[model samples]
Target: MPARRKDPAIPAGLKIMAPEPAVRLAKEAEIGGLGLDWSEQPEMLDDVGLAEWERLAGVFAHDATRFREGERAAITAYCSWWSAFATAAADVRDRGPVVEGRSDMDRGRLVKNPATVAMREASQQLRYWARELGLTTDARVRIGLADQGDDKNDDDNPFA
Candidate 1:
């Protein structure tokens, strides 16, 4: 098991939650900005999709206030993107990349299938969601996941 990190000591009258509960709450709560809780439960996703969602969720897990308020829409959007990305990626894997179809003018020649296009669009959205959710390298570094070149104690740096 990965080492369990202690929750940061909070001032009196404050509460904090671990990642898993924060994720569950974000998904299940009926938040106004998310528009009727379109987000799926973590149990609904396949392993890969679930992992991605959890990773994104963990970004805000430490900050209960952010997860509770501002991130609701973002979390739901990420879930929506995950569904699209997973479906498109799976279809491309199971079926060949090219989609076969008929042209508008004549039914004889098929216009290229839109599966590739859909996949590309979903991929782009997934990338955007990852960045927004702090899954990107720059985001991770800012959140203390990825190490910046300066390994020295940050307190020692006067600017910090």
Candidate 2:
């Protein structure tokens, strides 16, 4: 059997439990940023992508430094996937999951709508990009961006 792929190493800045030695090593190994501006939207993006980009930018505004130029491509991909998913989802909603087949043999029969496939593919891609960009709640927690809920005092509460 093939070996499982290892998880990507978390950046020192995003690691909540790194030892001092590991943190120092990670800092030394970190590459310098290209200093690209995050505010500028890529011209290739359509209106839907642009809106998603803006929404994500606003979401990360408080910790903008965490996303350097190295992450721009990931952010762009996430936005693009979001746009695709949204469009596909809308199409599926309007057309329903099944539609008349356009192929020769299946012409008169009902088949799964193309939009349903698109939506599934887009959602999968979106999930991948979301994890890469730390956009999901679980991703945020994994990267030490979200509160881990460890601060609650279980000893003091009867619910514990």
Candidate 3:
């Protein structure tokens, strides 16, 4: 039996989703600009597609805002890029269960693979962009995760 081939179109990062508002607003913006009904666009952003969408959303937000448009635009762009990259990484991580289930399957079983490697690469690229935006030497290094490590910072959590 031949090993089952994974679908090329179904990359590990495909499951990644952007922020909620991003998904809604970006699609609205895109469709409105195109003068097309939102539901009519079957190709309208799924979660993964929203990653790219948010980047443009950030651009729009920055441009429309009254403050330091240039600085805000750059900052928002960097954040959007990071979020997209992170979501992509998370998608790869989500594949773990599928891949594990294939362990005892026959050679012909289609194995779900992770795009962690690819996600990491994209993250690296985003990291560089973040650094450039922040004017930091180690944008990728010494990074922080979403979860706050200590209780003192627990207030930052929305649920708190």
Candidate 4:
């Protein structure tokens, strides 16, 4: 089990109004609202991404059936990294695929920022944890997730 958040932003009415699963996450993650809304408002976590983000968050937040210890910390790290992802993505989104910045060695010279690299790295972190926690759609399917069982063949999937 993980320690409670030091400063939980507990939301109003979620305890009574949210759906059963979301209510569980709110309590387990000790988050405000249904643990469904984003703090940074990243486009990556909006639209279809919102549903995916919420689902992934539920796995990290729920308490009754944790895969192992330190889950809450992992959840917090995941969200923090996602915020980083969003911020970096925002730069890329606004400036197009490439942007110009001054080189570290020489401020006078122009250099390409290529925010996509940072965006990709942040996205990779999110994806890595999702796979680690079995939160991805493909991961869920491979582990017989609909029936809700651990991936018994995890050892057999040599590539994994």
Candidate 5:
């Protein structure tokens, strides 16, 4: 059996009040409330938080008419939740290596998926924000994408 999912460490409140699931929780926490006291609970938000959901709703609101056209992916709304569990590290500089590693991992797994690229982009933006805010060090930003299992090579593809 798969390992039990870990419970989100975020506190009971401070989450967005919306029920929508598309908003990226980390983005919300980072940019939603200014100077929000998130020193506790690992400083991460859940994908289900109301505030994040509202943001997701707003993104869709840009083209509300497209829903009937089947323009959105079933998982698009939930993908942003992946970042909600991100911890507000005690020191941004200290976590730089980890963030870099996570970025590379996300990029490696982002093959053939536009959403993955968006997520990777969002992660990079967040890192820059952290640096600009003086919340962490900039030294750990990774410059190269690591080869993930999906790397396509002429030798492996029968069609190639």
Candidate 6:
């Protein structure tokens, strides 16, 4: 089997590396901006996508240092996926997940709705983008953006 894909190296800015080591590593793995304008929304995005972009942008603004201009495309992709997911989910909600099949053989049978499939695909893509952008709780913890605290709680047992 092929070797497993390696996780992307954490940017020097995200870690607590020493100044000397950080500077040395910078020469080999320097992270730079792409000069993209963040103020304007991408022309390709529709109204739903624009709203998603705005929502994500607002969340990212709180930790602007974590994200850079190089990640604009990733952010755009996340927004696009979110829009697609929202649209597909709405369709699936309006029309149930099971629908009458259009194929000749399955015409009378209730098959899965195309919108449900689209929603599933979009949801998967959204999850991937969320993890990539450190938008998920698990991603944030893994990327050192969140504190790793003990799991101790007053009601540890769910059935309690």
Off by over 4 Å in 2: 1-36, 148-160
- Candidate 3, residue 114: how far the Cα is off, in Å: 5.0
Pairs that collide in candidate 4 are none
Which portions of model 6 show Cα errors greater than 4 Å?
1-30, 34-37, 147-160
Give me candidate 6's TM-score against the actual structure.
0.68
Q: Which tens-of-lDDT digit does each residue in 21-90 have in candidate 2?
A: 7565456447635333667888878899999988877766766356777777888888888888889899
In model 3, where do residues sit more than 4 Å from their true spots?
1-68, 97-114, 135-160
> Model 1 Cα displacement at 143 (Å)?
6.5
Top candidate by lDDT: 2
Write one digit per residue (lDDT tens) for candidate 1, span 34-87.
322223444555665566666655655554444444465566667777777777
Worst 10 residues of 5 by lDDT: 34-43
Model 1 ranges off by over 4 Å: 1-66, 104-111, 142-160
Better of 5 and 6 by lDDT: 6
Lowest lDDT 10-residue stretch of candidate 4: 32-41
Candidate 4 error regions (>4 Å): 1-69, 104-111, 147-160
| TM-score list, all predictions | 0.49, 0.70, 0.32, 0.46, 0.22, 0.68
Tens digits of per-residue lDDT, candidate 5, 1-160, equal 9998645886655555775544544344444332222112222345443354355455445543322222122223232333532322222334332332335567543234334444466567655543432223332234232233535667977886
Query: Which one wins by TM-score: 1 or 4?
Result: 1
For residue 112, what is the lDDT in candidate 6?
89
Candidate 1 vs candidate 5, TM-score winner: 1
Please report, in order, the local distance difference test score of every candidate based on alpha carbons.
Answer: 0.63, 0.78, 0.50, 0.60, 0.39, 0.78
Candidate 5: C-alpha lDDT: 0.39
Expressed as tens digits, the lDDT of each residue in 49-112 for candidate 3 is: 4554454455444334212223443444455555566676676676652344445554655455
> How are the candidates ranked when ordered by lDDT, highest leading?
2, 6, 1, 4, 3, 5
Clashing pairs in 2: none
* Residue 93 Cα positional deviation in candidate 2, in Å, after optimal superposition: 1.0
Ranking by TM-score: 2, 6, 1, 4, 3, 5
